[model samples]
Target: MSIQRLIFFVLSALFFIGSSVWIKDEISPKWIKYQKEYYKEQAIKVEKEYSAASSAKEKELLGRRLASLKRPVYEVKQILLKGDYSWDKRLNGDKVDRCITCHIDEEKLKEKHPNAKEFPFDIYGCAVCHGGIGRALNEKIAHKGIYYHKRQMEQRLVAAESLFEFWSELANLTPEESDPNQRLGMGDFKKYSITGDKAIYVGSKKCLKCHTGLTSPHVERWLRIKFKTFELVKEAPDYIAGNEGYRKTCLKCHTTGYDETTGRYSEEGVTCEACHGAGEVFSYFMDIGKALEGQKIAKVGTFGTPYNICGPCHHTRNHEMRLKFFQERGADDEWFFPQHTTPYKTGLTEKGDASKSLPKIY
Candidate 1:
C-alpha cells in the first residue's frame, strides 16, 4: 500500500479503538449493569429455593452451595473465593486488626484445642503478637517488618549520603554515570520501595500485654540485654556486627534485631518471629482470601515453627564463616559451643506429637 493510504488507515483504526465503548479492552459500563441485574435475579431465585429448606443443617448446606454460584460479567464469569472476607477484632481500646479474615484456621485452633488460652483469636489478633502492618490487606504491605525496613531505609540513606561524600569529575558524564549508587533520597526505603513480605517481629511488647515474668520467664530472659560488669563478653574481632559478611549472612537467623546486641525494640529478643516467619502471610492466602487448612498449616509453619527452617545456619558446610572464624581464633566448635546438626524441636507434647494448639516451650 502507498504510505499516505497506509497512514490514513492506521489513523482511522486508532481513532475507532480510542472512541470505542470498550476502553482498555474491558467490558462496557452498560454491559456490567446488565450482568449485575442477572446476578440479582439469580440471588432471588436461590433465596426462594432456600425458603423450602427442612432443617438448619440443610439450610446451611444450601446456603454454602448457593454461595459458590459464579458471578457473570458481560461475556465472562468467575467464582468468587468466599466474597471479600475481613476478620476484625479490637486488640485494646483503639487498636483493631482484620487478620482473622484470612487466618480463619487460627480462629479454628481455639476449638481444636479448647484448653489453650493463648490462641484467643479475638482478644489477641495476629499482628499484635507478631509485628506487621495490621491494617494492610495486601500481602507485601501487611507482613513488612519495621526493624528490617528501618535498617534498609537507613542503609539506603547512608549509602546515598556516602556517595556524595567522596566524588570525582561529573561535568561531562551521563545521568547514570554521574551517580554510581543511582538515585538519592527516594523517600523512605521500607515504605516506598522494599517490597517483600518480611514479618516485622514485634519483639515482646504484645506478648508482655498478657504474659508476665512469672508466666513467661524464658521470653523475658531472651529479650533482655544483661552485660554484667564482672563477666567478660565473648569477643569476635573478625565477626564484628556491622562487617560486610556478618551483616549480610550471619545475623539473618543468629538473632532478630536492628544490630548484633539490641533487637528491633529494646525488649525485642528471639520471639516467635525468629523461627516462625511473619504469621500474616503464612496464615492467609491473599489470592484466595482464606486461611491455610490442614497439612498446609504444618507445611507453611503458620501456627508452629519447624526445625527445618533453621537449616541455613545449623546444617554443616565447608569454608563457612563460623568454621573459619573458629579455626583462625583457636576456638574449637565442640569446646566453645557444641554445634547441633538440627535445631531441636521445642514446644512438643510428651509423645513427640505437636501440642495441637498450646505452645509448651521445651
Candidate 2:
C-alpha cells in the first residue's frame, strides 16, 4: 500500500475510535455521575448503620445493604409512566420519565409529592405535575419548559394575560373600586394544584345531592339564581347573535369550570363547585360522612365574606344589565342582584346582599 493511503487509514481508524469514546461518554452522561455519588453515599450510610448494629440480624441486613450499594448499577434510571400523559396527544404510547435518573433520591421526591396514591411517581411521573421533557436524558433538554412551582402551571391554565384583560375591561366598565393587576385567585389556584386528577370539576349534581334538603335553603336559593346564569345569557338576544369573543367572555363568568385555553366548561352556569372549588377530594370526603374534612379539603370560604368569591362574576357591567333585565321582565324577586353602589355586600345569603366589589387584580 502507498504511505499516503496508510496515513489516511490510520487517521480514519483514530477518528472512529475518538468518535466511539465520545458517543459512549455522552450515553452515560452526568446521570451516571450522580448515581455513582448516590451509591457511595448509600454504602457509607449502611456501613455506619452496620457499625451501630448490636443485634446479629440487624448487622446481617446492614452488611447486605452495604454490599449491594458497593456494587451499585450505574445506568440511566427511568419510570415507565402508564398512558400518554404527553402535552401533545398525537404522540401515543407509554411515556418514559427519565427524571428519576438524576433525581434518584426517592425520599426527597416523596417529601415534595406527599400523596403517593393520587400521583404515584412511578405511574404518573414528574412531568405530569411538573412540566418538562420526560423522555430527554440531557439535563438542559430534560428541564426545558419545566414548571418549578405549581403556581406556574396553574397560572398558565388560567391564562393570566387574558384574565387580566377580562378583569381590566370589567373594572373599567364598573363603578366599584378595583385593581386590575392584583392576583385574583392565588389561594383558589392552590386547591387546583393538588393533583392533575383533582383539577377536574365533579359538577353541581354531586354537591346538590348532599345540599338539597329543606334545611339548606341557601343552596336552593343559589340554584334558583346563580345556577341559571348560563341559561339567562343564552336566552339573551345579544348573546344569541354575539361574536365568539363576546360569548366566550360571558361564559368565563356565567359557566362553572370554564377553561380559557379550550373555550370549554364542565357545566353551564355558576354551580356549587364554582365558588367552592373542584369537588373530587371534597366529595370523596363527604361521601364517607366526613363533612368537616371535605369542607377543609375543598377550601370552602366559610369564615371570610364571599366578596373575593363573588367579585369575579358580579362586576358592574354584568350586575347593571342582569338586574335591569330581570326587573323589566318582573323576575327581580327571583334573581339576586349585586349592590352596585359603595358598601357593597356579596348577597351570598338572605342577610348579606350581593356586591359589585371587583376582585383584587394584583
Candidate 3:
C-alpha cells in the first residue's frame, strides 16, 4: 500500500476505536457497575434466606425477591428536589440528583439517617446537606466537593458565609447585625441546616449515662456549675425583673439545643452535648462498643479552650448588668466578664493573663 493510504487507514482505525469506546461508556456508565454489584450482593443475601426458610410462605417470598434481583432494572435513579431562592434572592429552581443511582443501598442510608422522615432523602436530596455535584454520573465528578462524613459537613457549615445570611433572614435583621458564631453556639444554624445522625441532639442524659462512670470528677464538676446556668439565670435580678422578650434572649445561651425561631430548647443549662455535639450517632457508636468510632463522631476534646464554647453567653457584650458592673469597677472596654482566676483559662490551657485574652469566638 502507498504511504498516504497506510496513514489514512491508521487514522480511520483510531477514529473508529475512539467512537466505539465513547458509545460503550454512554450505554453502560460508571453508575451501572455499582448498581450491578449492589443487585448481585442482594441476590446472594436473598438466596441464603431462601435456603434457610423453614416455611413454604417465607420461601415463596424469598424466591420472588431473588428472581426480581436476578433480573433487576438498571437505570439512572434521581431525586427531583424542589428548590427555592436563597437569602440573597438567588434562584435555585428544580435540581436533579442522580446520587441515589450509585448509593442504591436504601437500608444502609436509613440506618445512617434515623431521622430520615424529618428531612426525607427523596424530597430534599443528598446535595442539600452532604454537598456535591448531585447530577453527575462519573464518580470523580459526582464526589468533587462532597462531604463524606458529619465532621466535614460541620466544618463546612461553620465556615459558610451563607450561615450569616440565613441567620439574618431568620432573625429579620441585616447581615451586618447577625452573628454566625453566636448562631453556631446557640445550635440555631445546625438545627436548620441538617437533621440526622450527629445533627439530632440526644440530650446530656445520654452522655452522663456513659461519662459518669468514666470521668466521675469532670462530670460532677460540670453538673454542679454548667448544668445550673439556666436556673441561675432564672433567679438572676435581670431575668426576674426583665420582660418576656429579654428572658427569651437569655434562653439562647442558657439552654442546650435552643431553637431561636421556635423559641424552644432541648434541655435547661449548658450540658455536655452542648459543648460537644449532638449525641445520637456518637451514642450509637459507643453503645456498639466502638469507642474509637464514637470519638470520631463526638466533638470531645476538640475545643482547645472554653472561650469558643463559653464566650457566647459568658461575655459582657450583651450582658447589660455585668457590663455596667464591670465598667463601674473601672474595667477596660476589651475586658470580658466572668474572669478566670487561675493561670489555666477555664481548665483548658495555661495562659499568662486570662483576663487580657480577646474574644475570638465570635
Poorest lDDT segment (10 consecutive residues) of candidate 1: 165-174
Ranking by lDDT: 3, 2, 1
Residues 1-362 of candidate 2: C-alpha lDDT, one tens digit per residue? 99999999999999999999879868868889988988898788889889999999999988888889989888778887544444465455666788999999898888876565545677656875676788888888889888787566545442223223322322322233367545334343333433343456888887877678833888978888889867766866446656887678788888988888789889998887778777765676677676776666555442474566777776766545444443444342234333334423333335333322322110
The TM-score that candidate 2 achieves is 0.43
Tens digits of per-residue lDDT, candidate 1, 128-215, equal: 2344665554445666763333344334322222212211111111123355534322111111111222334444444345446545
Clashing pairs in 3: none
Best by TM-score: 3
* Model 1 spans with C-alpha error above 4 angstroms: 1-199, 213-234, 257-269, 276-308, 329-331, 334-362
Best by lDDT: 3
Better of 2 and 3 by TM-score: 3
Off by over 4 Å in 3: 1-17, 84-93, 114-117, 154-255, 258-362
Judging by lDDT, tell me the better candidate of 1 and 2: 2
lDDT of 3 by residue, 136-175 (tens): 7888888988888867765553222444343333333212
lDDT of each: 0.40, 0.65, 0.66
Clashing pairs in 2: 181-361, 181-362, 182-361, 182-362, 183-362, 347-353, 347-354
**Where's the lowest-lDDT run of ten residues in candidate 2?**
353-362
Question: Considering TM-score, where higher is better, how would the candidates rank from best to worst?
Answer: 3, 2, 1
